[model samples]
Target: MSLLNEDATIPFISRYRKEITGNLDEVQIGEIVKFKELFEALEKRKISILKTLEEQNVLTTELSQKIHNSQDFISLEDLYLPFKKKRKTKAETARLQGLEPLAKMIMSQNVNNLEQTASKYTSKEVATIDDAMEGARFIIAEWINERTDIRNNIRRELERFATISSKIIKSKIDEEKAQKFKDYFDWNEALKNIPSHRLLAILRAENEGFIRVKIEIDSERILQRIENRIIKSQNNCSAQIEFAIQDAYKRLLFPSLSNEALSIAKEKADEDAINVFTKNLKQLLLGSPLGEKRVLAIDPGFKSGCKLVCLNEQGDLLHNENIYPHQPQNQTNEAIKKIGSLVDAYKIDAIAIGNGTASRETEELVKKIFFKDKVDVFVVSEAGASIYSASKIARDEFPNYDVTVRGSVSIGRRLQDPLAELVKIDAKSIGVGQYQHDVDQTKLKKSLDTTVESCVNTVGVNINTASESLLSYVSGIGPKLAENIVNYRNEKGSFTSRKEIKKVPRLGGKAFEQAAGFLRIKNGKNPLDNSAVHPESYVLVDKIAKDLKINIADLIGNKDILQKINLQHYVSETIGLPTLQDIVKELEKPGLDPREKAKVFSFDANIKTIADLKTGQLLPGIVNNITNFGCFVDIGIKESGLIHISNLSDTFVKDVNAIVNLQQQIIVKVLEVDVVRKRIQLALVK
Candidate 1:
């Protein structure tokens, strides 16, 4: 299969295709695609189970099937009760140990002579009828428990019947930081509804000995069914055996099974949260393309002279200089001249002022100049610009320039293209919230990696322009190979074609197979490279061209001719209907960016102060955080707003993330604006 058309999921394509992916490489994309498939398949299996049981006559086919098909495992178990089997219990053991006949004799008619039924199964071991009947009772109980169907049913039933309990098991776990997990000491939410972040937090709290949690479920009803299935009581098992079966359930089985349910539910929540975060991150990373913009970036500072860098159409810094523009000594004249000259010389249209110290002042100066010139001013978040400045990537990319200069250029590129520049910085360093640094680092990395991968695949990459930092986030490629490709590019000079990328050190045929589709080569020797068609599947194009009696170009975009051919014949171990269908879609729109359009927004000059805000005012805001509590929105003023997690959506939102994401632009109404304390309570009305 061609790499572009290779239906070999993300994992298969990435692991095998090293050479083709380049910097916006392929490692993470495969995991996401594969996981998504796995998740879908699990949902299908869940549905299949319900359908099978419904057809078997044990359940009401229509209404019961609906409950079974739902993803809620607890609800499904409720309907599975009748078909469940009775397994071996103490009662079953009593029956099996030559006492079942005696038990049945007790269940039959008026038992005036109860001694008679017990005598038949008597031996030295069961010398008395009471002992015989007791042995029979044990056998019957054992039989109930051994039934697999009954076990499955009971497991399902107990999950819903369970109650989650939390206790402040320890007071001094973190006496210094006791407040953090204090709210969790008495948690009792249902397992099915608990949010992933909260669940992980509670689990962490429990692990640290700050709290103890236990799930309490109804075992009596579950045991009763088991008893009836095995003993068939017209009046069965001297009630004493019934008590023993109940004891077995409570003492032996229920605790472990209930815990299993909790574990499974917790897993499901984590998986779901990870998936959602990954999706949001992908969208944020690969968001709209600002196009090949020529920009001048300014890193605003006080003591340090404001760093300035001008990037060309391709994002390469063409000019770099420094100017002390603010604080104790603001070189207003010198700064203006330098900036004005560069804008005029490079025909620069925009100036990206970093949102740091002296930023608004810098913007003010730029705005004054722009009032008389062609350049416009914009304020960009310098979140991870400093981090990137100190990293090895910045050193290698701008070897001759100072650290601040590189940061300024990165700030400019970020404004022009977020995903591309943000890729250069560690996701962790892009400070969007509090506690981001202290949270579980490993968990954060996994989440960030997933997000980067999803974004890279969604936006795809321009093979020619993407840097190694950006490329490393691709599904299959990692930091090492991303460096190798850059090294190869430096040694080999500019690549004029995608095929040449395969020759880079460490990149082989397998890697190329996975990454080739996503990376594009504009105006390359082979038109297919500019599109997603892999080199391996060039023959398929050739065959199609030959069969159509036309050249590859003519066969590519012709819908009428391409639609007539049957795709099933192409299916194989290497290729399937999914792949074939993808090829056809690519033929229609080659090298499409899957990201959404980035809406342009500028801070309103009149609304520069929090005091200017009015009640019930509608404004555009950027999401600065997504926390368990709420979203913090930066609404152009110096102070950010609190869209208390409750205000993120109208529904009862468990996860604040589901309603708003970091860096998302949302339209909000100022519900209660305060200037005294500098607080603005906002709501996403729509």
Candidate 2:
């Protein structure tokens, strides 16, 4: 908490301050940060409520004490419900007629001859005994609604017994767009037992005007429960109080508590959806990288031709053109000759083809050609490549190029380093989420941003070669500081050491302390600059080297020597064995990427389209998108197949992630295929 209060980032605190944090991981620290902010917001709301109560002259000693002791928002709001300002209401109108005394008489159950007592309160507003009685009942109903115990009781009942039901709107039932939600047209389920995906689907149907959703419970039972608590005796006054209780239950309590219950359910659903998205996004961002390979990338198309770009080892665009290797232009010979010449001319290391229109055909063409040197062929997912191409970052990076050329460059770079190129595009646009648009956008963005930051910081960045977009995700450096770092590098040349990061504008001591370990400077003056070791511990490293009779360069990557050093000997009050152990691990392989090397995967050659697929046939596929229900796999065709949770294993499956991950290669047996609808069902084959 203290570290977070000092503006320290979660990655920095969890990684560098292990002694202070007792070795808490990033997820635990993030939970602490979330609750800390929530606590502060609750405190702020309490202050606002107190000031409002004081201004209204309703801050009694007991009420003030209750407000101060309230632990949750629902309880605090219940305490303030009676005093909350309101527009014209039935109770207010009855109060204007001076009927409060009669209402209190009925509530106490002490009134005899209630008709005569009601008649005594009659006036122009209440012209008869019946009118007065009705007005008094309205005031009594409002009082019942405001009671904390009554409202809480209703909430408890709703939580335990509520059922959610949806029905199609008769007028819109035949509409073409409404057919997609027909499954939910007449659905009923226990609210607590409904899955998040199903609930979200029903809510979406309601939002789209195709269905009317309702939350319901046993109203008669609830009414009896309320009457049991409120009625003291059977009399005329009890009958009048009973009328008020029914009015309150129908008009005020049920509606409020039902909506609150639905809101809580929706919030839980959103959290579930966002967690799945967060995990997929993290996996996609941390996907294996080909590691700075010189590449020739192609964005395949049929009529418009395949857009081709050659990127150097640094991913700088050296050349771009067009190749038509598909139908409508029988220029396969020309395309083949052009590709061969370019590969030889640039000494290409790999060929990355975007897995989009005419991808399989282009891969076959490229595979048939004879090149001078060995080159691996990769089909990269172009999920957000078009989005990134049209973005301002792409425009800034390649101002003179068109969207097609820029997209081809993005595909190639994604093959080389997915994290660096992906951070430049929006996480939502990458297409890993389920119902992303329906979830809370603000929370989704925050979670995705945090996942990107954690992945980037975990892998560590090369300060000299990293773009501003990638640099922005480094622990403490945001967009402005990242821009400043880039501008400083452009003006002064590549950074020679990690210490030079401090010279960038607006980068203070704290920022440097948090960011330095995650930003590597390769071949720097000090060997530790390229590792995950902070500069504050440089003196300690120097001392260790002096004791070993070796230089810093000799000590680094010397596993035999590093293992012999007693980490306990270096532990101090501020630094413990955890920190020392991490240092030794980093020393084993300084500046090593934690991600594995990207491998070339090939889909079955016989499968080209949905028409080619046969039931019970096994084929290779990649898991593309995941939801709470199942995962979608791209099986070398336009329609990705669904591997439902049940089909994922013969045993009971609890989590989809436990079965497969994003971009994971697996063999799946075809269970069913609907060519007209382009839906394919697959089962994971062990």
Candidate 3:
């Protein structure tokens, strides 16, 4: 924790400061970072609570000790409840009427003549002794409600036995729109066992005013427990104490603890949902890339015609065309001739078709055309391509082109490299997550940012050609520094060496040191600069090359020569075997892509729509989205099929990731089809 406080990023601490952190990995270090922030927040809250109590002149030695000793916010809040100021509650009004002393006397349980004692307090304000005792009972009920031990025990009960139940708004139940949430209309489940997706669905329905939801516990059991704690004697005051206990349990404690339990459950659900979203986002971002290739991409549409753009190997848009391949303008012959000409003229390597409106028709059209060269056709997911099309990045890149052409360009680049192209769009708009919008937006963004950073750093970036969006995710470079790096490259020409990066504006020594290793400069002057070997470690590589009696260039990618060198000779106080091993590994595969090359996936030719799906029909499918429940697979149809976790394999499967991954092509057998819902259920072919 102390090490993390010194501006040390997770990757730096996990990779470089292993000795200080006992060799904790990135995930463990990230957890420590989160908890450290949590502790600081708790400390701030403690200070605020202590100051508030002191200002109210109610601070006591025992109370101060308990507050200082609290380990969680709930316990601390339970202790502070008695002193918290607020709008006039029933108990506060009674106290203002001067019934607190009488309440204290009633709680003492030593008063035999309770009515006679209450008579002494009777006045114009009291009206009658019964009224006075009633006010005392209200104060007593509040006192019972405020006891920390009592509140804590009730909280435990709520946690152990709470049930979340929802009911449709009576008038909305008959509405046609309410059918979408039919499953949750009469839902009742144990709060502890409810899955994150279902919880979020329920919340969304409640938010839309279709249903009312509440957490419930056994009220009688709670009353009995409170009575056992507060009712001490069988005297005249005992009956009043019992009444107060029941009043507190029913009116205050039960409601408060139930809400608290629901809060905890909601928080847990949010975390679970966020984790799912983060994992899905990571997989989608790191999906296979068809390395730099000339791509003719198409954004398929019916009335608007298919928006077409030809891109060079570097994803530079060279030409744009609109072809009416389907529908009202069924100029198939003209579209086919034009496509063949474009393929021949541009020397196209691959065809990327956006999996959107009229995608199947466009794909059929493209495959039917006789190209001069054999071209591999890819159906790319254009989930957020439209969002990126009208974005500022797209506008800056292609000022003369409209959104249709820009969208086609995005689809083309996404096929060329997913990580680089997808970074320009918001993660939430990618449509690869479950209940994303329902989760905590702040937490979701933080998690997605961390995931993007991890993936970007894992697969090093090309500093010379990377966009500001891609460069911004590098280790230490942010939006401003990324823009400056791009501007500096434009003005100074392509960087000949990694050291030239120091000339970029506001890129100080610290920023360069953190970011330089993850930013690759291919074909740079220094061989080690193109590799992950940090500038600080260049001396170490030079020493190895000197020992071999050869130039540094010969030392890189020479596994046989590298093997003969002794690692122990290079060990020092600062550099250890872990880093030395990493250097050797980098030398072997310097500047290599960590992702697999993209492959063409085709669905069953017979199946073009959900209506074509039949039970027991085997078909090829690509895993598109994964969740805790299952994965959604695109089987070349208008409706994607769902492979539930149970149906993923013949044996019991605990995690869906263990069985399948994003964009993995596999064969599956259809199990069921719902034509009305446009749903297909499938099982993985053994």
Candidate 4:
């Protein structure tokens, strides 16, 4: 808590302060952060409630202690229910009519002649004994609803035995737009057992005005339990109390508890959906990179022609043009000659083609052309390329270029390094989430931002060449500071050492401490600047080098010498064995990228569309999107095929991610194909 309160980031605390944290990993530390915030919020609410109670002159010793001891929101609210100010209700109206004394008499259960007792309360407002008894019952019902034990019992019942049901609005049942949610129009399921995606679908159906959703439990059983707890004897007073219990169950208790149950379910569903999204986003961000390759990229189309751009090793756009190799303008010979000349002229090491519209045709054309050098070919997912092209960031980066040229450059850069280019666009628009639009927007943004930050810090950033978007995700460096760093770099040329990072305007000592270790400088003045070692630990490294009679440069990457050192000898109060071990490991492989190099993937050449697919045919595919129920695989066609969880393996599969990941290449056997609907069902070939 103290570490977090001091503005230390999760990645920094987990990586640098292992001794103080007992070596907790990032996930564990993140949980601590979440609960710390929750606890602080709870404490603030408690203080407000205590102050309100004092002002109301109802702060009894027992009630104050109970409120202080309450750990969760539900329990705290239950304790405060009776004292909470409410709008004009039946009980309040009855109290205003001077019927609370009769209500109290009935609750005591000692009055044998309840009707005669009720008659004494009759007046202009309460004309008859029956009217008086009815008013008294309303007050009794309110009292019963306020009992903490009664509300808790009902909450437990709802949690264990609730059913969620949805029905279509009859007026819109036959509308064409409502057909998509028809399956949920008459749905009933156990709320506790429903999957997140299914629950979100039902909720969305209700939101769209196509259905009305309700929650239900066994009302009679719950009422009986409440009666057993409240009733003491069988008499006229017991019967009156029974009437109150029935009213409370119907009008007050069940309604409130059922809503709470539904809200809890919805919160859990949101959490599950967000977890899936963050996992997928992390995988996509950490996907393999084609590092520092000069490449020719193409965005394929038929009528608009394929937009082509050649990028240098630093991902700068060297040139861009158009080539119509397919369809109406079948200038195949001219296109091939132009591509060959561009490859030789730009010294292109690889070719990247966007996997959208006419991609296969372009791939075939490119493969047939003879090149001056050996070049690998790749098909990149252009899911959010168009979004990036029209974005303000893209416009700022290339003010003179058009969207098409910007899009082609984005595709090329995505191949070079996905994390750097993809950060410029919103994570939700990247097409790697399940029901992203339906979940809580604030929570989705926070989780995705955390995932992006973790990924960026885990693979360290290059200080000199990283974009503002990439640098902003580095620990303790935000958008404003990132812009300052870039402006400083542009004005004074590339950074020569890590110490120069502190010179950026408004970047103070604390921010530098948190961000310096994660920012690497290649071939810097100090060799450790290119490694993961923090500047605070440089003196220790210098001492180790002096003891070994070698310079800092000789100590780096010398596995034999590094292995011979006793890690305990360097351990201090602040730097323990864990930090020393990490320092040695980083020194052994300074600036080594943890991600694998990009590989070339190919689809079956004979298949182009849904019509070409046949049941029982084996084909190669790439897993594109994943959900709780199944994953969708792209098999070189417009419509990706679904591999349901049941067919993921020979045994029962609980998690779809355990079997397949995003962008994973696999061979699948077609189980069924509905060409009319463009739906293909596949099974893992295993």
Q: Pick the TM-score winner.
A: 2
Considering TM-score, where higher is better, how would the candidates rank from best to worst?
2, 3, 4, 1
Error of 4 at 195 (Å): 1.2
TM-scores for every candidate against the unseen true structure: 0.64, 0.98, 0.97, 0.97
Error of 4 at 240 (Å): 2.8
Please state the error at residue 137 of candidate 4 in Å. 2.0
**Cα lDDT for residue 71, model 4?**
100
Candidate 4 per-residue C-alpha lDDT over 1-686 given as tens digits, one digit per residue, 9 for 90 to 100: 99899999999998888999999999999999889989999999999999999999999999999999999999999888899999999999999999999999998999978888888999999899999999999999999999989998888888888999999999999988788897898999999998999999999888889999999999999889989998999999999899999999999998888999988998899999999899888889998999999999999999999999999988999999999989999988999999999999999999999999999999989989887779999999898999999999999899999999999999999999999999998999899878899999998998899999999999999989999999999999989999999999999989999889989999999999999999999988999999989998999999999999999999999999999999888878889999999999999998789898889999999998899988999999998888888989999999999999998999999998999988999999999998865689999985
Quick one: how many clashes does candidate 4 have? 0
Looking at model 3, the pairs that clash are none
| Cα lDDT over the full model 1 | 0.69
Which portions of model 4 miss their true places by more than 4 Å? none
Instruction: List RMSD in Å for every model shown.
Output: 9.9, 1.2, 1.5, 1.7
Better of 1 and 2 by TM-score: 2
Tens-digit lDDT track for model 3 on 1-686? 76666555676666666657777887887788788878888889999999999999999999999989998888888888888986888888788889999999988999989999998887777899988888999999888888888887887877788889999999998888788899988989988899888998899999999999988888888788778877788998988888888888878888888888877888888899888888888888889999989999999999889988999999999999899978899988999998899998999999999999999889988888877678999999999999999999999998999999999999999999999999999999998878899888998899899889888988889998899999999888889999999999898899988889999999998788778888898888988878877788898888888888988887788899887778988889888877888888899888888899999877677887888878999999998999889999999887889999999987999888899988889999999999997778999994
- What are the lDDT scores of the predictions, listed in order? 0.69, 0.93, 0.88, 0.93
Assess candidate 1 and give its TM-score to the true structure: 0.64
- Taking all chains together, the TM-score of candidate 2 against the true structure is 0.98
